[model samples]
Target: MKVALTGAEGFLGWHTRVLLRALGWPDPVLIGRADLADAAVLADRLRGVDRVLHLAGVNRGEPAEVAAGNVAVAEALARGLRRCAQPPKTLVYANTVQAGNGTAYGDSKAAAAAILAGAAAGCHLVDHRLPHLYGEHGRPFYNSVTATFCRVLADGGEPELRDDRELRLVHVTDAAAALLDAPPAGPWDAAMPALRIGVHALADRLAGFAATYRGGDLPPLTDRHDVRLFNTYRSHLFPAGYPIPLVRRADHRGELVEAVRSHGAGQAFCSATRPGVTRGEHFHLAKVERFVVLRGRAEIRLRRVGGRGLVRFPVDGAEPVVVDMPTMWAHDITNTGDGDLLTLFWTNDLFDPARPDTYPEPVAAA
Candidate 1:
């Protein structure tokens, strides 16, 4: 289906794009700031699209600025829709649960939703009221408290609790799913389900992750929420926390090295690849995977899903090191030496065919 998106570069927008890529959908028509400011341009971009996910609005600024900015963007969108020769079949508005809660931001969001609804005469309008969202690559101090705490913990600092209120949190990917996977026939208004945690409790959980991860061990990821939180924490540690050198001990018989240290259950295995061959041209949504070169020279390349630029790492058995793959990154290992390459692989979960959680995308093309 042809889909168009506004605010396609924001944190949630980026995650939505990543989800679209994971679903094998064609790239959406990106309605950026310029297009949103021009009625004709926005209308032209929206033309012929099956769905238009309207996600543009201001949430942080002076009260008057915030209020005006939010309403203004929605007005522009409404004007654009009026100019469209054929309105989109579906219009998904990324509203918030806080909408109409008497705050400037909340009131503005409610007004914005009303504007879009008024403009969407014959469209299936899905007003998705998202909860507090947290996920990989969320901007610290701006997106959510989970992101701010994750950043603080990753930086070897303690999170200072300012408010201990409860948060009903939803991962941004799930929020994106709500927008993309809405029912075909709907003029419904709803909020996504959320995971609840108090501010202080959330800080403590992240603190535990920091303490466990600092020692090169995987924390206890006992559930899906835990896995998502761990992945969010790991996002702040990648490219710098990788290539952890294994402590090599030499005695009489042979050198003994502890490759992986885990605080939870997992699967460990190895692979042998011929020289000049490659393996693993895929990305995982929630799996924590590790690569260690036990007996050959190799290179591991990773590119962020739905993005450009490759992160490269060279490894050798002589000085084996741990390179853990970050979730949502397309990665691969290539035998660079003339000899056969032996590499150790470890994942926090046993392989399940029905829920593989793997998507194929070339690192070179990312």
Candidate 2:
């Protein structure tokens, strides 16, 4: 069957394309759009499409800007669907982790979801609300903790951890697999409603894989990532009602104790700016990491040679669980909170700058 994908060249979009192909689906019609809100342009490219995978939006930045981006995209898509003489079989929107919160990004995504939940029957719609996304096709800066930490530690610098924050994660490949295997139409099913994985354990497991990954001079991105990238300090480890866990420098220790203490002989650390801050814009050939949102909110973005995409996680400032970053992706952390976000930082093993294994990339021409 044929499918139409918006954000075809993006991280998640591109991965989804591969998964579709693996599932025996034909070449899906790729509907590439720079902005999601532009219905006229989107609709023009959407013709003759069987399904639409909406995976475009600003991961982090000003609240107004994020809300505008998300709301406009969904509204425009809905409007476009109405204009279709024969709507596509279904629509699967790649939603962010911050969908239920009051944050601009979260609220906006939630609003967009409402539209998808009630889309016209002829044009079926389903919201693929995903957690932290990491895989081989990710950017160096924001793919996952595995990717991020490997780079941070690869340079042999002690990572500055967030202390507290809880989050979730998932692998791009697994996410892609899930997407392609998803049932068509709206009203997500429990079997395939939406999947959430833990990035911490995922990272540790991959770290085990890395111990044996002695490939070329570059790094090795692997499959499998958790939704909660790290152990978020939940409740903003500080005195702020931002929902993030209140935290301190020592809280970092506690974060690791909970996330990776069981790994034995290995350690985990975190490195990402508070909400509103941008961190990654590169990639790795054989690295891995796990991101944990301890407090506030943030967006993790990834871009690679072939594609890119952004994902939002509304923390309201709290503790993180963990998310894994793989080598095949580039990464960066963007904090999205009004208060100082408390992020739990950890790593899989002792850093090795001498054997530094990672790569880099850029966001746009402009």
| Candidate number with greatest lDDT | 1
lDDT string for model 1 (172-264, tens) is 877887899833222111234577999999999989988987867788989767888899998988888777777899998989778888888
Q: Work out how many backbone clashes candidate 1 has.
A: 0
- What TM-score does prediction 2 earn? 0.52
How does each model score on TM-score?
0.95, 0.52
lDDT of 2: 0.52
lDDT of each: 0.86, 0.52
Residue range 130-232, candidate 2, lDDT tens digits: 7766544245465455456544433433334544344454556456555555443211122432234344544344343334321201122222122112211
Runs in model 1 lying further than 4 Å from the true structure: 182-193
Q: Every model's Cα RMSD, please?
A: 3.2, 16.8
Deviation in Å, model 2, residue 333 alpha carbon: 37
